[model samples]
Target chain A: MSLFTQSISPETLSVATLARIESQGGIDPFASPSHPPRVSAPSFRLPARAISAITLLALIALWWLAAQYKIVSPVFLPGPEAVFRKFITVARDGFVDATLFQHLLISLGRVFAALAATLLIGVPVGLLIGLSTVGRGVFDPLLEFLRPLPPLAYLPLVVIWFGIGEPSKVLVIGLAMLAPIALSTAAGVRAVNEERIRAARALGASRLRTVLHVTIPSALPQIFTGLRIALGAGWSTLVAAELVAATRGLGFMIQSAAQFLVTDVVLVGIFTIALVAFALEWAIRTLDRRLVPWSGRD
Target chain B: MSLLELDHVSVRYQNAVRDAVADASLRLSSGDFLVLTGRSGCGKTTLLNVAAGFVSPSSGMARVDGQPIAAPGADRAVVFQSDALFPWASVRENVAFALRMKGVPRRERDRRADALLARVKLSGFGDKPVWELSGGMRQRVGLARALAAEPRFLLMDEPLGALDALTRERMQTLLLDIWAESGTGILMVTHGIEEALLLGTEVIVMTPNPDTGQQGRITRRIPVSFGRRYRAGEPVRAIRADPAFAAARAELADAIFEGELQ
Candidate 1:
């Protein structure tokens, strides 16, 4: 039979058959009717907010029960109320010499600075490596070598080279963010659909124009994924960097609190870090939706 | 002078034992619709790529307006089998891409894009993202994008091979309409025998030559009069249903299968 005229058998056209098809993840043959259909509210999957809220409440309840019953010892795992009290105290007075907000700002500033530096330097180098064999040959070995090494492995060297100041801390975090951003960008560029490139070239686009319009845009979805990963890496590296160095960030606050047996303060620091990391991830995802809306669709 | 000429062009990839396209010659002038038809692995697409400057010929030359095509240029545009539309761009921007590359003002390019979109019967779809379009509609957008360049020669590599049969038939009619209106020379590659007869002013059947140790060469060249007859305002269904059209299609199909057997 011609592809256009082929039809489902009569046995396959029943409501039961249609339901079976739908159950099997095939299209709902009865979704659209030939005549006016019944106007009914469409059903949807469970809302993500509800699921998250339930999970969060359950975890908090478990934590409260554990502390109330002394299951794990309050000294080691503080209750949610204790953490909340600690948060209020830190917000009102201070942690160490700086206020909670000040410590957060300092950590955030370091991460953002490192991220900005990473993007500025990494994106262009990544594109160059992606576009040119020579660039790849020159940089691939070094990037590969540095990428596998843990950021903390070279912390001593970084401190010795740049001194245990802001620059050294920033350098370590920036280095941590660098590999993911550069590698992902390069992969994105390399993974640009060959057909799109051909289409652009055939449409009379110059090499530079093709790279700007087609290559970069095509690579963007993957690049954003890389950025999200890099942000996570930078955040973790910031904590590591601050753990060994000066005294103004969340990491330093958490470390000093532990030394003084201030478990509630450490809990506050952990929650703050978790919340901020979550916010950064959400922001990147929102940006991805706005900028490259077509990324994952096709 | 011909708009596109391939004089005994041969393309062979590195480390390949035989030429992908072996000493094939063809010409496309304004108002010409040349179709290449063959079975799988016949290298029809390779030949089309050679004409489009995507693939370099190992011997002989492929030229446009008597100038050897060293690299892809604005003078020739290609409609790939896959629509290849930029999924991120709206239909208007995708169609206006060539003009935008030339640094044309946004207003003028959008205007041109609208006109081209209308020509492809996608008048109100200019704002839609390419991913939203169906396969046939995407191909139409691809055609509009190719035409936006105002190329002297339009090349296609199995442009409708992905569509449903009904959509393919509609697209064939649309393609003929565009060719009739634009008067641009076309060199299209296809595997459908009936499609070749229905679309081409001249149809060439390609086949791999085992004896000659060559991969692809033209086995037959048949000048078609039916497309001209159809273009002269005859009812499309009537023309397609005619005995002459059926005979020609069958003859071409037989020749292709026979070449395959050889």
Candidate 2:
């Protein structure tokens, strides 16, 4: 199955790592006197993931019972089958001149595009706040001002300044993301082990070389965390930005459905967004595992 | 003049009421293994940091052959108490970090790093990440990395402090071996009186100055021969077994305890 359909979660990653390590016959890297010995068998632990799965089933059963009993109006809370049927129809035929896949693709495009822009702008800003007193003096207050601002709070102001266009949409999303990326980058830079920097200095590294080789690499895990947070912010602000103008995105699809009180279609859109967010988290986590493998291990 | 000297060096940190190291005089030569031992508040580490050029003396001079030390250089490489290794790099890469900073070629650096790792007896473990290694192994990597700089004086701040007792003993032997072979001037700081006596050609016990209320000052200096005895084809346990070794440890311990109580 594609990553979007995969039921990846936080708990599974650790279990998978443990299984891989045990399979290789190496003792657990973190095994200590306090830690109990590993089972050395396999990944399927009953109490571990089964509880979440059961909880999900119970919630779905409750939803079905409530729908069947007409406890809430159908316009507000549709049955699961109705939502599923709407998902199929939207995937095959078009919903508001675009299919479900098209809406999803456009939404992903906007988020990723905004993500690219934010990364380009945010990383250097973060480094500045981290590296020099002057950089911190200039940028720290700006970031403080920008952070904690709701995307909706800035929507009208962005629209007024940049005009209602693709730039404004991307701008709005990018603004929401810049603070997390920049702030996390700065924190990571500041948190780099003091001795590591001192070691670099004593080893004939020039100031610039020390930053490029030691400082940047040391700050990478934190930078990646910032990116993940920025991506999350992008997803959250996606619908708000799309609600502004001409759009063929997931946010627009959900908003369009809500206007007509198409509760089933709205549920389907919401579910798709949630699933896609999970997929994004999984993809970034895999990337983090590959790129910053030393993060938590130390 | 000594090759490295802390000539009555004293340091008072910003906003501090007293000096960390108060008018402390110490010296080490190319073949000397000098150990500074004291209570927790005593500036054994602060004194070492002065020699390493990490901290500047507030009222006294730190010098190299009377040149006056200004900044840290590869001439004096330090192995920190925490081992302060780069987690992002593999063992070989971490070992070669000094060479890499010197614009050495990748292949030559790798070759030299592997040789150094082997010197530390971590052969075939060059490709491993630092965290995968045991504490003792990581300390070895720190030593190997310091050696890669080919420093004239190898300054260590309790480099084996985090290791288990057995590992710490093994590391003490390795350090003595390195000192004899490389002839690098060694300045080390430690709390273990036995460790100081076992490894130091000259051991100094410093006490926090009661007058200054937390400033460190050297109170006693003793020249010992166990490190030299270990060098003279003597086994470590044999040197430790000697009555002289116990005597020196007792003297050092007494000084530190009295310093602590004061």
lDDT of each: 0.85, 0.85
Runs in model 1 deviating more than 4 A are A1-62, A69-73, B210-214
TM-score for predicted model 1 compared with the true structure: 0.88
DockQ, in order, for the candidates? 0.65, 0.57
What TM-score would every model get versus the actual structure?
A: 0.88, 0.88
> Can you tell me which runs of candidate 2 are displaced by over 4 Å?
A1-49, A69-71, B211-213, B259-262
Candidate 1 per-residue lDDT over residues B81-197, each given as its tens digit? 888899989999999999998889999999999999999999999999998999999999999999999989899999999999999999999999999998999999998888888
Q: What is the TM-score of chain A alone in each candidate?
A: 0.80, 0.84
Q: Write the per-residue lDDT of candidate 1 for residues A1-298, one digit (tens) a residue.
A: 0011011122212332233234346775576687356578876767888898899899999999999999998999999998999899998899899889999999999999999999998898889889999989987887877776677799999988988889888888888777777777887899898988988998889889999999999888767766777788788776688967678999989999999999999999988988888888778768978898886566
> Proportion of native contacts in model 1?
0.84
